[model samples]
Target: MAPRNGYTGEGGSSVISTDLSHGSVESGESLQSTSSPHRCHHVMRPARKVAFVYAATGRRFLGCPLSGPDRCSLFMWIDEAWGPVLSRSLIQLWDQAFLDSGRAARLQTKKKEMEQAYLELWTERSNMEIENQQVVNKLKTTILDTEIKMSRRLEFHTKMCVAFISSAVTLASVLAYVLSAH
Candidate 1:
């Protein structure tokens, strides 16, 4: 009979074997049975990935597409056991890849913040420059107004002096004519 999952163990617990051969004792089916009963018609039907568990680290295996309570007994090892040296190297490499990806994300966020700060500073500088230009224009207008007022005052003083001299000369002539008539 092709093992339909539920089998009793030494502790009388309902032990379900996700692997093809269940446990140590051989089952009715072969160890590497790809033509299992419950097969999904998906493109990657038999899910395959490297095992990251402590006991079977760096080993590649094919498992059932379903997980947890719905998993079937459809597991098979694709790669053989790795040597101690190779296993350690692969674990370290996986760790480094994780760390590098996190660091790269942080750096990207920092770059965006710096760009925002630069934009704000540039805007402030532009506003200050406009304000300075306005102040300079106002100062120039005030100076022109003061010069015009001074020019008008000088013209008025000159006219008053000419009129006073003409009046004095006419008075002196009238006094002479009165003396000659007498």
Candidate 2:
């Protein structure tokens, strides 16, 4: 039997008898033909024009029509019984690519942050070293000043002792001369 919409009986077993001539079959009705020729004819349909966009690659595939097996592979229908398999695959790939890019960016940012922190730490360490050197210089100066003051005090003490000895000698000589003259 001739299928509706000018479909030659190419699909599965026809609901109507296949022995009957093509013109005898009524339109808009299934056939019951078990013959391989009729079944092949029923299965074969004109390829429809389809356009698909791959989400992952941002690429478009045009004029690619899906067969019966290809239609079953897709999870969702695109439109007019077309499968969204290619589109869905493209979308998944695109999502993965975006995620990878995001991860890479985050890592790069983190690395920069770490480098900045390291530089700051180095600067602080250098400043501390300068301050330490200054402190050492001040300590050395204080020590030198204390040594000079101690040396001056020792010299003054030595001069006082010499003057006292000279005075004692002069007193003794005067007593002896006066006694002898008397």
Candidate 3:
């Protein structure tokens, strides 16, 4: 005989396992049953991380995901305590190590930023130095051009002065010859 879901015969001892709402089954057809067991599936939630203070003294633990009505009442300690003093000291050391690593990471970032700024400043300084050299070259060329112009002007003035002196000397000698002949 197959298992039944509800009460069936005489003293209610005979149970039929198939659902009667889907279809009616006669007593003759009870021997030809093909029903499976009732399986209840429950979803398992993951544990949550929690920090305990006071008596736990800043320790960490994993608690059940549920609370209130459907709580699974699950709890597990992440940190094991050696003793009060030693555990607190270890926790403090771990905290300090974590803080130190964070500080080191921040310092590394700042160092990179400073290095990048320094590189930019160096590049700008190099560009400025090149610009200054170009300006100096342009100034030297301008001075050279001005000096050539000035030298040419001086040469022209000197030739004009020599011509004026030669003309005065020739005119004076001719005037003296005429006066002496008279």
Candidate 4:
């Protein structure tokens, strides 16, 4: 029977069938029919592609289109299920690919976060350095001001000492001259 849009099978799963007569998928050759261990038939609807990550590696598989609770348990790998060893290897490869892609995405997100944090820390450090330099400059200015005040006070004290000594010598000379005259 010709598969129609929104068609449901007896198992209650939505089915989207592909026309095999076209013999080509868009531009490439049509996908030949093959038996799978899990699905009734391999359904290829480009518009209805799904990424199935449960099949060991993260690979896209042909499964029921219905999502959530309505989705059917149809898990069929895209690659051919040939000999036992070959099929197992293929599944492993697909699973690894999926895992690697997921990890890569997470690592990229982490790298961005780290870069932002580093930039913030650098900015904080620069601000602190500027503040420290300002404090140093202020300290130097204060010391210089204190030294200038102390120097001025010392000069004033020295001049006062000289004037007092001169006045005492002149007074003693006058007393001695008066006593000698008497």
The best candidate by TM-score is 1
* Full-model lDDT, candidate 3: 0.52
CA lDDT scores, all candidates in order: 0.56, 0.45, 0.52, 0.51
- Model 3, 1-182: lDDT tens per residue? 11223323322233323222222112111111112222112234333232322234333334444443464444455446447775566457546755787899999999999999999999999999999999999999999999999999999999999999899888899999999999
Off by over 4 Å in 2: 1-83, 166-182
Residue-level error in angstroms, candidate 1, position 143 = 0.8
What ranking of all candidate models by TM-score puts the best one first?
1, 2, 4, 3
- Clashing residue pairs in candidate 1 are none
Candidate topping lDDT = 1
lDDT tens readout by residue for model 2, 1-182: 12212333233322222221122112112223222222122253322222222231211111112333342121211133224785576557546756787899999999999999999999999999999999999999999998888888877777777777777777778888888899
Q: Candidate 4 overall Cα lDDT vs. reference? A: 0.51
Candidate 3 residues lying further than 4 Å off, grouped into runs, are: 1-92, 177-182
Candidate 4 lDDT, 108-166, residue by residue in tens: 99999999999999999999999999999999999999999999988898888888888
lDDT of 1 by residue, 1-182 (tens): 11134332222223233342132221222123244344544433565433443325434455655555565666666557777877676556556756787888899999999999999999999999999999999999999999889888888888888888888888889999999999
Q: Give the TM-score of candidate 3.
A: 0.45
Give the TM-score (vs. native) of candidate 4. Answer: 0.46
- Among all windows of ten consecutive residues in candidate 3, which has the lowest summed lDDT? 25-34
Backbone Cα, N, C clashes tallied per candidate: 0, 15, 5, 2
